[model samples]
Target chain A: MRTDAAPSLAAPWRKRRTTHYRRAEAITGVLMASPWIIGFLVFVVGPMIYSLYLSMTRWDLFTPPRWIGLENYQQLLFNDPTFFQSLKITTIYAFVGVPLQVALGLVLATLLNQKIRFLSFFRSVYYLPSVIGGISVAIMFRWIFGTQFGLINSALRVIGIEGPSWLGDPNWVIVSFILMSLWGSGSSMLINLGALQNIPTELYEAADVDGAGTLAKFFRITIPMMTPVIFFNMVIGIIHALQEFVLPFVMTGGGPADASLFLVLYLYRNAFQFFQMGYASAIAWLLFFYILVLTLLIVRSSRAWVYYEGAIRGR
Target chain B: MTTLPANRSFNQSSGQLKQFLIYAVLITGAVVVAIPFAWTLSTSLKTPQQVFTFPPVWIPDPIAWWNYPEALSSQPFGRWFLNSLVIVLVSTFGTVASCSMVAFAFARLRWPGRDLCFLILLGTMMLPDQVTIIPTFILFRELGWVNTFLPLIVPAFFARNAFYVFLLRQFFMTIPLEMDDAARLDGASHFQVYLHIILPMSKPALAVAALMFAQFKWNEFLGPLIFLNRSELYTVALGLRTFVGQEYGTDWHLMMAANIVFMIPLILIFFFAQKYFIQGVVISGVKG
Candidate 1:
């Protein structure tokens, strides 16, 4: 992670006759980054340390924290069915939503990458949903999926089909969320577009010469080359999906029978709404560990799939 | 070699077909994404009677420009707008200054534990913010910073945005080594080099960082919801939530109006800095 600039700069500084200049460089660097360091120590690191301590204590907002060792974690593991339910929901959501989004995004990006008219206009239109605030999107989805007088239902009625109450039904809430999420797939699409453009045209031409059809060329040439970007999007998508709160919070309130009760939503309820800070902190730590382990797994497995042209060349 | 010409004709026809398929798929995807936004714009301009009508109108019959002003005056929207503006401005400035500095350090300074620090920074990205939310809330409460803008604004100063720092570090690392060497030979200190040489060269990155921070802070609902308690201190996002209640009689037109108004600044900024935004994404991807 230490860039080449650092050592080269340091080597020259070490040979300098004046020590004042070196000290000044160090001082300035620290000064420039002080906000982040200070912020990290106070906000991020401090809270992280405190969360560990809080996990062992029962602390409401008004009352001084009362120490209760192992109770929160014990209750979460053994006693609470809601925690288990939330975990199940979140796992399903992450697995289902993340892959779908990534795949849909890649497909959309590939389609858009062709030499098409009004390319920028289409790109902007596709990206529109991403800029709309999450709450707004959720609200918009609420109207779209409304049981009575909804646009979706009306459209269904036009086709002589009955549209189920999407947000209202426990079985459909998660699906509704997943469908709503597709509107903002443009961010991942843009990233995929970048990866697609980086691919050499010669590869496609070479495939053409070899009589590789469109589908074959896409799978053999485009997909393998796009694996790294796909992996990147997948990891980020999982992380984002796992932490999904705003949409569910505004839309379903974790829903009719706790069907859409996401892990983070449950954590927020425990901490803010219910004032069980200790219990919430425990949930938070569990989530942190879950993400850490998952990311580590992805990173470890990346070598199997993620192909870097440069690394291949070096090899 | 005799079959090459026939193969060429076959390939050309297939390529044209493939192109046609691409256009078809892209147009459908674009429409799917655009419809919701179009619906919102149409809904916001509709009169209350027009909104709940049967066979819901795709466009309002008579445009209700009054809905915008009505939404503005519905709640403490003016105050909310000011609050959002203040927080976003402060946060963006803090993020840019802090992230750039940290990025510069990671890119240029050969300090002990720099690698460890950078790794830790990347590792933090994987850590769910939800895990930190409660502890951070408790910390804020302990410092009596809750129910104030301090909780939202203060963190920006501390390179709290590890993603931006990581991004800028990548950009800074790409700066030619000779530029720094030239600066050093000209009796320019590292600080001067960062300011005069690196800063100017990395304007696109800096602008990108600033724009992202602005969009993030402007649209932020959770942080403001958690920290700022009073109605007077509500951000535009927080205020918009007040439109919906547990009751069935929610004001659809007004809510849509507020949502549209809240989106204005973001849309304006987005259109203005789109070039830089695209550049930022490209650079981030390349670095990745």
Candidate 2:
């Protein structure tokens, strides 16, 4: 027993030396991550807590915060019609725009995945609108969707169809915003393209050997395998679409009778334009919860569908 | 398999038709994407009179090249251009530097609570900017950072961009640990390993992140819209808004011209870094 105890004691000394090395590594790691940690505390975490506190108070830029205690939430939930309208508009925008964008992106990616000439050039061309600033695209679409002398109307004229007033008419304004969003679906398309390329040619080869036609192979082999990537893009696209601001802000100005009044845009107007700081803070928290819940739901649902091919077999 | 010999020709012709149909569908989709940009250029080159012509000049008989110069000189175009360049460059550089450092730590270093810290970092991505905007605005105002580039540049230097950090971290993790072990054996410090080894190998990811950051910063409207008060400090996005005042209808021709100018840099960057962009995406996907 004494001999075993002596060896164990010596082993701990060796372990202590390794621990010293690990401690040194930990210190370096902390130093390296310090910028992010500091920024997180100062900019994100600190401000979030502060904003939560601010939401309970009435504070303008010139005045100190006065504790109102749930009044802001009360105003948002029951008193503000614009808040409800904005939520409705945002819901419509997210549901309509996100699905269209994702479907279009998948289609474009599938098309581009085929063996084709000038593939890179075409992709770059398609992706150009996305890299262009939101303001610039909004401005460009304003010209395209203009009531008079707009390019879209001119094109419609060539086809013997009269184009509707896109940004001017409340009925057509949301559609214009949707169109503007489609131009920037290139990023999601790129993601889909990457996912497509990764679909292990072997799987397709095996499917073909089994006499599966292209459509059959796509549905059976491609779709299931691509589910995870699709899920990722879907979640991200929904999140981004919910926060849609600049395009609607610059293009429609939340007008044509609030047709394009997104939640964030309304929040911006409330805080900046109307100077309703407390109310805006309340709107912000509500948005945060909305996004958080939606994200968690998606994540939860992903477990049943997102196939980890290797992990399942191994585990 | 031999029973279908008579139907083989039928299937062959159908295949040809299907192939042609697929091409037709894809070509139309491509055309749909391309037409808007083409229309923008065509409209920018047309005279304002021609722009309003009833039949509409699809091809301007005489291109209005003066639109570029006239549109530019009509406002502080040069200032806007300089302002955009300064902000984009600073933000891109700051993001690249800070995000790389944070990513390196998360990827390579074995530290206590490293996983927890990383989880927190990723969790922050779930928080929308709207939730933080009001508080960030107040904080910036308190710090006297409003009406300046500080709000844009300072946070970027402090690893404010979690998405980019996550992206870079994933890329960095793909690198062989043996490289770092070898460097350590050669007496290289962690900073030295980062500067000499990790960065050199992580060029593709860094370039992708930098280009993306530049594009985002260049196109950023909300941040500048909220923080920037004066027109002199206005980014291109904000500067374009000046043309859109309620007292007057927007000058479409000049606005389009300024837009063309604003897009040129991004267009060039996209074309040049297009390869890196695709490479980064593929690599990140494979690694994840």
Q: What are the per-residue Cα lDDT tens digits for candidate 1 across B30-91?
A: 77777776787888999888888777788797999899998898788999899998999998
- Candidate 2's residue-wise lDDT over A28-57, tens digit each? 989999999999999998889988998998
Off by over 4 Å in 2: A1-17, B1-7, B245-248, B282-288
Which regions of candidate 1 fall more than 4 Å away from where they truly are?
A1-28, A313-315, B1-11, B246-248
Error of 1 at A250 (Å): 0.9
> What does DockQ come to for candidate 2?
0.50
Per-candidate DockQ versus the true complex?
0.49, 0.50
Full-model lDDT for every candidate: 0.81, 0.81
List, in order, the clash count of every candidate structure. 4, 0
Which DockQ-derived CAPRI band holds candidate 2? medium
- Residue pairs with backbone overlap in model 1: A35-B157, A35-B158, A36-B158, A36-B159
- Model 1 C-alpha lDDT per residue in residues A107-207, reported as the tens digit of each score: 88777777778877877777667777787787787778877767788789888889988888888888888888777788888788888998999999998
